[model samples]
Target: MKKLTLILICIASLGLASCKKDTIVQSANNLTIIKYIEANQWQSSADGFTLSASLSDNRIDDRTFEDDGILVYISRNDGNFYEQLPFVYDVQSYSYTVSKGRIDIDIQSSDFQSAIPDKPTTRTRVKIVLIESSQ
Candidate 1:
């Protein structure tokens, strides 16, 4: 009986050791964005807006990584929407607009990579920014 128990314990320990540790795969698929600041002038004279976005690089293969793009759809307080592409060659882009009395900016990632090439299951991080312009 003791021998049987000892063998089972050893087997369990070996099984645990053989299991691979969880690691975050970094990838170019991760996007990053910069945040914008609101200016005081934007309050009265003109409405201004700025924003940026990108994907996170953790859990993705840099080799298979491709340039992630960003698309922004902005909606003003007055119920007007505008679309803009803010990524160029895997880099972040900035957008700005000024009007009479309202500013709105929204940003999101526009591209993705296939996870099957590297492994069965993969994870990634995405980011977005909302900016209210001041100038």
Candidate 2:
């Protein structure tokens, strides 16, 4: 598809750029940030519900924001301690999206068999990781 091809090209460009001097590639490392979203914190969204956390620690910067990779994990009591996002458990799906200094985790019904549930009535623990390559 044209869109997919364009996305791949853009990603390739960023990768090449990061390999240059004074870029994120030189500082390729992992930075982990943890946050707890209370039962009342999840907010409604068209897809389902989301909880936004601030990247106040500055682990992610604008120069290489798109060049970096983001990983999200969710734990629900025994969601195996923490299962990576875009994973499905108990028919519920989990995922995330990130921007300059923010991360928004989303939850919804996996099969489209049902509507996205209301904000969970229980607390959730999330772990966000950034794989920064550096400028």
Please tell me which predicted candidate would have the highest TM-score against the true structure.
Answer: 2
Candidate 1 residue-wise lDDT, 25-126, digit = tens? 544433334323332212211221222222232322332223222333422222333334333223222243322222233222223332111110212122
Model 2: pairs clashing at backbone N, Cα or C within 3 Å: 23-134, 23-135, 24-133, 24-134, 24-135, 25-133, 25-134
Per-residue CA lDDT of model 2 for 67-127, tens digit only, reads 8788878777524488887887776777777777777777777776666554566678788
Instruction: Evaluate candidate 2 by giving its C-alpha RMSD to the native, one decimal.
Output: 14.8
Per-candidate TM-scores read 0.27, 0.63
lDDT comparing candidate 1 with the true structure: 0.33
Kindly provide the TM-score of model 2 when superposed on the true structure, using C-alpha atoms. 0.63
What lDDT does the true structure give each of the candidates?
Answer: 0.33, 0.69
Estimate the lDDT of model 2.
Answer: 0.69
Q: Which stretches of candidate 1 lie over 4 Å from their true place?
A: 28-40, 45-135
Worst 10-residue lDDT window for candidate 1 reads: 115-124
TM-score computed on alpha carbons, candidate 1: 0.27
